[model samples]
Target: MFSPQPQYNSPHNQGVVDGIISGCKSFCLQTSIHGFNHIAAPKRHWIERLLWLVAVATAVWGVVDISLGQWQRYRENPTVVTLEKDFRTWHYTMPAVTACVQNRTNQDKLQNAIKSRWNVTPESHPTKYLYYRRFVDVVTSSDLYHLEGYEEFANDPDLNVDLFELVVELMPEQRVKLSTAEQITTPPKWTPVMTEVGACYTVNSLAITDVALV
Candidate 1:
């Protein structure tokens, strides 16, 4: 008689059992989606974001300031020619010279010498001679001095007007790029013309035509 009535779960018990099963399933699903020990990705705090922004801004400002400072320094000190009598301010070792240009007379002498040696006389070819003198001054002046700063003496009104004119004229043409005096080798066709005097004389003779492109 006692066993005849099979034990039956009450509504509350059945509901509890169902709830346990549902809970277990939910737990399993959550574990599968996020590993049992997985750590959530941390969110960036507002303070951290603000600090990063500040750091980036500071770095950018520093770079801009440094760039502007360098530009200003370059402008203040420029890279132009300097007419120095003792010219010891070379980037490389230079040979000791017996004399340095003191006045316009030195340039005149040089011009006359170039005319005599190269036969580029002002009377014969005035235009050629003009360009020839310009090239000579540019090469000689830059070769003998520093090129990254303007010397105070270069700004004098009476100082080397011809030299200044030559540099200014050639700046637009991009022909004043050479920093040192280089001896140009004679071409095979012109080698015989220089045999009588020397290669040096030959190079000087052809320099006018080469530089002037005339």
Candidate 2:
């Protein structure tokens, strides 16, 4: 007589398996993920399950496709620099030169302007005087400064002096020399540009009209 074979599908093993299935069903039913509940539903039809399977497969394919595309882009352009060597002689455009003034505004010029334009002095109109004095700083600074009382002045274009005009008028005249192989002495056309440090001047900028080596 042969020895009796041990039963793999015992009642205890079946109970443990049932518990796991129950837990999974409960989790699927309560889960927020779409189509999971339908897939796990006890009374779900074969057709419904097939449709959900297709939808899941499509979603996975889409994600994989996007991942592959990004990987391809990275492989193609791993670094930002692209280099090319040329042996032929070529004339290159001049680089832009930017100049910033240490003193953003002239206090004397500002005082005079205010006195002439608004007929107000620090003694007479302390609030206006202080606001105007701090105006450039406020405008240039990254931090927000309180402008509670000077809203009217800030809003009115006529009340406020032109920033570029103020910069030019107050800025001390400086001589700029440009020399080339031919001893070009033509003055560089300076264009007013607003920078983080207030009004600045740039030479050989695209904004300047008729840019030439001379």
Candidate 3:
């Protein structure tokens, strides 16, 4: 007579099956509890939300204000040139200024004025006028050429106010005329019609006596 065989899962297999069933039940229970808790949690009152929003905004504003203050501290002061026209002369003073690019623009404006006075244009003696541009850069870049405050200028034992005069006297047109041989032999030495006063003492607070220039 034949006997029926009995199959049984190994202990390791049984343990795995039991663990899977237990884990599924635990996961389901935890999910249900989590769902209920989330539903039961009290909603934030409108006033509380508004307060939180205000707090966040205030924090952001504080950060921005601090950043702006730091930036202002490190940033360079504006280069301001005050020009006054009295009688036949144009008197200009830059109380506090640097040799940065902004000041460079102010310098350009003065150069243009001089150029206009001399009637210097690309069409009229282009090569000759170009030399003035090169010469002006060389002369102004020197430390001695930067302008100081009026006080410093006045106190200087060796004050040359005449030299500070911004004037471009165009030499007689006949004098500037050069022959082909002279042009080839000499890289024409040029004198800048406009000159700058030496570097000035910088002050944090400058008075605006004339707002017209502003």
Winner by lDDT: 2
1 or 2, which is superior by TM-score?
2
Q: In candidate 3, list every pair of residues with a backbone clash.
A: 146-197, 146-198, 146-199, 147-197, 147-198, 147-199, 147-200, 148-198, 148-199, 148-200
- How many clashes in each structure? 0, 0, 10
The superposed Cα distance between candidate 3 and the true structure at residue 38, in angstroms, equals 91
Best by TM-score: 2
lDDT of 1 by residue, 104-210 (tens): 12444665555544578788899877766655554344533344333534454433335433332232211111224433243212111112111111222443354
Lowest summed lDDT over 10 consecutive residues: which window, candidate 1? Answer: 191-200
lDDT of candidate 2 over 1-214, digit per residue (tens): 9999986878998899999989977976898877777767778899997888688678878989999997887778766323333424444656788776665555557777667666778999999777665664443221123445455455667555554454555553435555544434567776656554545667888754442212
lDDT of each: 0.44, 0.63, 0.41
In the range 31-135, model 3's lDDT, one tens digit per residue, is 643232232234857666566556656776898999888677556442221222243353333233222221222344545644654556556778846655544
Of the candidates numbered 1 and 3, which has the greater TM-score value? 3
Candidate 2 TM-score versus the reference: 0.38
lDDT of candidate model 2 versus the reference: 0.63
